[model samples]
Target chain A: MDLSFVIFVEVLYGVASLVLISAGLAVVFGMMKVINLAHGEFMMMGGYATITAVGYGVNVFVAMLIIAPLVVGLIGLVVERLVIRHLYGRLIDTMLATWGLSLVFIGLATMIFGNTTTGISTPIPGFAFGGYQVNGYNFFIIIVSILLVITMYAILRGTRAGLIARGTMQHSDMASALGYSSDRIYMMTFFCGSALSGLAGAVLAPLVGLVPTSGGAYIAKAFITVIAGGPSLIAGLVSSATSFGLVSQFFTFTISPVIGEVALLIAAVILLRTMPKGITGRFFKGKL
Target chain B: MSRRASQDVTITLVVSAFLIWFLPLMISTYTLTVLVIYGMLGLSLGLIWGFGGILCFGQAAFFGLGAYTYAITAINIGESTLPMILAVLVPAVFAALLGAMMFYGRLTDVYLGVITLVVTLILFKFMNSTAGPQYAIGNARLGGFNGIPGFQTLNVPGDPSAYIWGDTYFYVCALALVIVFLLVTWLLRSSFGRIAVGIRENEVRMGLMGYNVAARKTMLFAIGAAIAGLAGALFANWGEIVTPNLFSLGQSAEIIIWCIVGGLGTRFGPIVGAAGLAYLKFMLGQQSMIDNTLIMGLILVLFVLFLPRGLVPAIETLLNSIIGHKKRKPKPHRMRRARHG
Candidate 1:
């Protein structure tokens, strides 16, 4: 019974982390229809921001929760005004331009960070749970993700700003006809998406050693999660993350971590093969 | 044949002949061979991406598969001929399977790109972790991060005793590239290639017109994979080593940059792009003061923003404006049709 409880926590943790990793990409790609290939880089910059802030003697929570997201969001705002703004409707061109941006980010990071791994220890300590030790940080991540989902749902569903953003995303001309500037909406949405990515990176930095190219490791996973989630933003993100998280964790506990990743990718391929429209696209229909 | 067609053939032949003769003297066989291999790789992508309109993010996966397949087969059989053939065949077959799944599933372009990227990254991750002795397939060990080296290199067909390397190998690579280039040009002019391009322009219309768009796309994708495999086989011979880095994101990104910078939809553009960029990368590798990736990234951004039509198309436009009408002039309508064709 104790081991099962531990396993349950692990699974939840897995699902939450997947959600966190892909939240920014979900906003950018799902709503905006812009493939921000630099999504992972934005997260990487967030991680660096958190580390730098913490080094400058700020509170760890403040560094992670505030500074990192602000820095990365500002960067995103600049990227939006410059590159993404120009290649709005052209899908392939946007992908190429963003890919170039990703490379540029990686190059800049390598130059600044000296191409070496840097990381901080987890603030929370491990505690005993029956025979196995449970990471206290896991609980922190699970809480953060729960709160994130609630906040996103509440804001997007409840606020007029969210409605305007959604309206602009669906039909910019219609949104513009109603007195809201679609350009400003797009710019703000991009900023939020980028900030979310940064937050995810900052929160997760304690778990892994950070490298300039660490973004590459997360790009595929985040893309798979967001793509597999389908159209309905929050519902799709939660459901797919839950399913993939369970599948990957199950395999990880049963076999190995690498096989777990392989299984997740294979599952995604099979899922895409079966449901080309994604889970939310078929089932949720019109839920945000 | 049309006068324009014959003229194009004559120009291609003359250029190939001149390059084959002159390039060896201008640069070392080592650098030239690498350039030729990269050119072939770029052409593979150019064929599918430019003509077929499939922007695969993992051409490196097939390239890596070809290299690994050749290395393993060569080590086991101790013959270069079968391994080289297997290299091409394996990636082609793999691509056919992958392409069938994506195309038949009717996934969107973004999903297709994401799937291909994931698959290649999976291969990269898997290959990097296989450092144990149990990872061996027959006599060849999957050397993990250190990669597989010390395999039998390319030799004359059916004769293990005769080895091919240096200048002879460069000549063979250049010949293969020329043959592939000419074949691709010929294929594009055929009815099947025209249908493929038609599907690329409008898949719904092609489907309505009774052409099997999915099957055509899969076939084109397989052909591209085959060409990339051929290049990978040559690369293994040139470098005499195959690492997991062959399947890296950077390698895949570089191939796309080559196509974009050279000019998409043109046969010669990819070769010129690959050769020029790869040579630049080689030069950059010799110095460590400035980051090579920074320069590459800046170039990709600049090219995409300013030179979207690429170097070849831009130059063609320039030539048309400057001296096109004065020399052997043609009607503007014919020129437009030729451009589309």
Candidate 2:
């Protein structure tokens, strides 16, 4: 393959990854007021689960299917009940508490797994599509992310649960007064957000090798995306992620990755200042 | 005069001065050095969070910036003291600029925290990645994963004293600590300090009173950054190494934890917090087999939930209770009966 062609393929993959992860985060943030600082940690947990499953002589794809989201979701539920539940309405306390929780989780993971990078075996060995040599595992991730997005959007907009969740987001007290169980909705939303983060981790584990500290890398970028896209708009987050990914990739190819990340962040900050409510906010200003 | 109401300001000053003068002789060099460094960091956080009510989670950015500035400039200039000054100045200026932008933009407390965090993270990533050939700075290589080393030591010109090591250096550090602490205390007691308190209490009221709340906040942030930068410079000179880890979220969280654990609004709370936590971590490190962080996390959770007022206030209340106070004199019986009727 030519050099330019390879770059194009790489850029496409980057854009796809950012969009998938950002969309998942947006859904969670929109529904639940909690900004999960340990979101990336959930992804890390999922990655570890995938690797562990593979190590146990399980079929890579099957192991990821069973282990990734389930383990991540379970951990998320526990975190919600034990720690995150105490953090609602209080932003600073929540941020500090979750940050400390992240550190503890990281320390535990480091102790158990040791400080080394581990890679999972590709789920579909020798899988290829046309001249583009697709990793069947990554393709599966993309498909799953797309399906998840579709399902989340449908559930958010078309179902009773979706309406209740939206009502809670708009006005928590009013939702409760209307006889809907806000607590249950909150729990479900937290579970779904964490599960999506886990799914991202499980799917990306094979693509990006797993390390104990790897989760820290994605967190700042995810935060930027969420803020720039406006935490309330899923479509805005998806678009922002795609744009950021493309910009990052283009800059990485032309200048350097480090410079690219810096540029993206600077741009994101500037954009945030200019458009505090994000693209969707700008477009739907009158109605929203 | 009421005995409890008597001012002991002179005695307090004399005692503090004596401690400042004699701390090196009283403690081991290691202990003295750690206390000085941690105390300085604690003061910085206290100024920012306690006075300004800005819960910054990324003072480590300024800390790392100061260290790097000192290290790089020292290497280039072939002198320690000048570079150290430059180090503190650079981070302070950077912080001032960032603060101005954030404050003027009208970002609230939470957004301010997020912006600082994002900036620090970006700096961390940039430094972490640019350690290779493309970003090398002379023989002091950025070294990506390895970090910069062999930083110059602070020097005093022509005193025939030579550069001190161990206890002597600890004495110098303690002296610096005393000076900075006094300066901070004075600042906090000044008119500007009262305005800062007013800003914290009701910024809208302060604004309506024409206090320029944003400018005050920005200035306070800059002052805090300068102090943090000073600590960073001292740390680099003491440790003789600078790394991207200094800018990490872990370091920032540690600073916030120190401030929270000590006492929020009290003068010595951060000092106590930093020293106590550092001592605990050091002791835990010695144990080797135990998971120290788990214990620390539990303590933090307990403190946040139960002892939210922090250790200093709790201690003060306990002391006040133990001292035994006189009961108030009863009101006139006739007046009391009339009031009741």
Candidate 3:
């Protein structure tokens, strides 16, 4: 029973982290179709922001929930104005440009952080749970992801601004005809997406050793989850993350973490092969 | 052929001849050999991306596979000849199989890029995890991150005792590059190549015209992989080692940047780009203050923003304007079409 509980928590933690890492991409790539290749770098910068803020003696939660997101969102706004705005409709050009941006971010991070791994201790500690010791941080991540999903659903589904953003994503010209500034909508959406990415990185910074190129590790997994999720942003993100998280955790419990990663990638390939349009495209038709 | 076509061919031949005869005296043979290998790698990508319009993000996967295959096969067979052939064949077959999946599935561009990048990362991770003694094929050990070293380098065909190194090795690599260049140039002039380019321009139109778009794309991808594999094999001999770094994201990005900087539509542009950038990277490695990737990223962004036509095309435009070449000055749209074609 204890082992099963441990396994269950591990699985949930895996799924939650996947969701956390891929949420920003789900918004940017899934809704906007902008293909921000620098999504991972944005997360990396967020971690750096939180770390820097914490080093300056700020409260961890404030640094994570507020400072990181604001900084990254502002950065995203600048990028949107300077680079992404110019290449909105051109998908391939946007990809190349963002890839260049990712490289620039990595270089800048290396210059600032000196290319060494730096990370903070988890604020939450491990505690005895039955016969097994569980990291309390695991539960924190699970709760955060649950809250994130609910918040995303509430905002995107409940709010008027959300409706306008969705409308702009579907048909910017139509949204413009309806008196919404699609450009402003796009700018705001990108900022939110970038902020979400920052929050994720800040939240997860304590768990993983941070490096300039740490973004590369998350990029493939996030891309796979988002791509595998398909058309409906929330449903696809939730469903795909749950499935991949389960698959990877299952393998991790059985074999090793490396094999777990390999399994996730293989599963993604198989998933893409069978359902090229993604899980939401097949099952959750017309869902948000 | 048109008079323009004949002139282009003559220029290519003259350039190749000039490089083969004069370049060995100008630079160290080792650096020249490495440059030529990179040139070949760039050409492979140029063929698929520039002409076939398949923006593969993992050309390094095939390159690394080729290098590994050659190292393993050469170690087991104790001969370089069959291993070299296997190097090309392995990546080609792998690409053909991979291409079939992507093209036949009718995956869009972004998905294609993601899948290729994922595949390359998979190869990298797998290769890195093969440090254990159990990861052996025949007598060759998959030497994990340390990579396979001390493999028998390239040799005279049928005579393994006669090792080809130094000046002769440089000449051989240069000759191979020249041959690949000419073959690619010839291939582009063929009906199949023209159809491939057409598919790039408008896939639906090519499919509607009764051409096998998927099959053509798969063939072109396989050819590109073969060339990349050959470059990898030569690279293994040049460095006398093969590492998982060959399949790294950085390596893959560098190849794409080379194509973009060199000029995508033209055959000769990638070679120049690869040689030039690789040399710059080599120089940057000697310095500690400046980061190579920073410079590369800046260059990519600036070029995409202002000089999307790339170095060769921009230079050509400048020269045309300077010399007042009337024949070259067609209507703008027609000129663009003619240049790409």
Candidate 4:
């Protein structure tokens, strides 16, 4: 029972973090079709923000939940204005441009923090679950991911802003015809996407050592999740993340973590080849 | 061809020939040979990306594959020719398989880029983890992070013991670079090359016009991979060591930067871009005044934003304006259908 329960938590933890890392990309790339290659870098920045804030004696949760998002969101706003605004529909160009942005972020981070690995200890201590020692922090990540999903769902589904954002994403010209400014919507959406990325990075910072190019590690997984999720926003993200996360963790538990990573990639390749449009592209068609 | 076009070609040929024959005497063998390697790598990428419009982000995978193949084969076979052939063949086959999956599966451009990048990262990760004794390919021990070293290098085709090194190696590489350049130039002017370029401009349109779009793209990709493999083979011999860093994201990014900076889709662009950027990088390494990564990032951002046409096309436009259309200028492929007032 303890082993199964531990396995369950590990799988959930994997899924949750996958959801967290890919959420921002779902909005920015999936909705906006912007193909932001610098997404991992944004997450990196978020991690840095939380760390720096914690270093200055801010509460870890507060630094992660509020300050990191705000800092990264603001940076996103600046980036959107200066760079992304110019390459709205040019998908390939945006990829190249944001790739450059990612490099810049990594470089700047390296310059400021040096190329050393740094991290803070998990705020929550381990607790015994029956005979096994369970990481109490895993529960925190699970809860955070759940809350994030709810927030994104509520805002994108229930709110007026959400409707406008959806409308803008689906048909910017049509939305513009209806008296909504596409530029404002795009900027605000990018800001939110960036904030979400920041939040994901900040929340996960304690789990792993942070380095300047740490973003590169996250990029492939995030992209795989988002792309494999396909056209549907929330549904696709959830489904693909669930599947990939499970497969990776399964391999991790059974054989080794390195094999798990390889399994995830192989799964992606097979998944992409079979269903070019993605899991959501096939199953959750017309879903939000 | 017109008089001006033939004249331009002859002049270019003469200049390149002179540079190949003369420059090796003046420059250090190390610098010239390394430049040759980048030039070859850039040439392959330039063909695929510039002409074929397949913007691969993981081209270093082929380069690394070729190097590894050569290293392993040369070690076992105790000869250069077979390993050299394998070096090119290995990457070409890998590329063909990968490209068929990507292009035939009708993957969108974005996903294609993502998938290629992931493949590269996978190769890097897998290679890095192969430090254990279990990971052996025949006679060559696949050294993980430490990489394989002291592999048999290039020599006379018939003789195994007669090894080529230093200036002789440099000259061979220089000659190879020039030959590849000329070969690429000839290929670009061929009917098949036109089809590849046309596909880049409009894939569906070409598909509709009864062309085997995917097959052509796969061919182009394979050819590009073969050249990159050759470059990698040379690089392994030049560096006398092969590390997993050869397949790194940084290396991939550098390849892309070279193609972009030199001039994507142009014959001479990749060579110039690779040579120029590699030199700039070497210089930056020697200096401590500025951060190299930061500058590279800045260059990427700035170049994309302001100089998307890259150095070559930008210069062409500038020269055209200066001469005020005194001669009939050849328009780059991007200019649509000769728009006249």
Best by TM-score: 1
lDDT score of residue B329 within candidate 3? 78
Evaluation by TM-score, superior candidate among 2 and 3: 3
Instruction: Indicate the docking level reached by candidate 4.
Output: acceptable
The CAPRI quality class of candidate 2 comes to acceptable
Candidate 1, A1-288: lDDT as tens digits: 889999999999999999999999999887778878888899899999999999999999999999999999999999999888987777777778888889999889988888999998899999999999999999999999999999999988899998888888788999999999898988899999999999999999999899988988788888888888898899999989998999999999999998898889889988888887788878888999
Q: What share of the true interface contacts does each candidate keep?
A: 0.46, 0.19, 0.41, 0.52
Q: What is the TM-score of each candidate against the true structure?
A: 0.97, 0.89, 0.96, 0.96
lDDT of 4: 0.89
TM-score of chain B of 2: 0.88
Local distance difference test, per candidate?
0.89, 0.74, 0.89, 0.89
In model 2, the Cα lDDT at residue A248 comes to 82
Q: How many clashes in candidate 3?
A: 0
DockQ of each candidate, alpha-carbon based: 0.47, 0.26, 0.46, 0.49
Task: Rank candidates, DockQ, best first.
Answer: 4, 1, 3, 2
Q: Where in model 3 is the C-alpha error above 4 Å?
A: B2-7, B24-26, B328-341
For model 4, report DockQ: 0.49
- Prediction 3 TM-score vs. true: 0.96
Per-residue CA lDDT of model 1 for B201-241, tens digit only, reads 77899999999989999999999999999999999989999
Worst lDDT 10-window in candidate 3 chain B: B332-341
- Kindly give the number of clashing pairs for every candidate: 0, 1, 0, 1
Tens digits of per-residue lDDT for model 4 on A18-62?
A: 999999999998768887889999999999999999999999999
- The collision pairs in model 3 are none
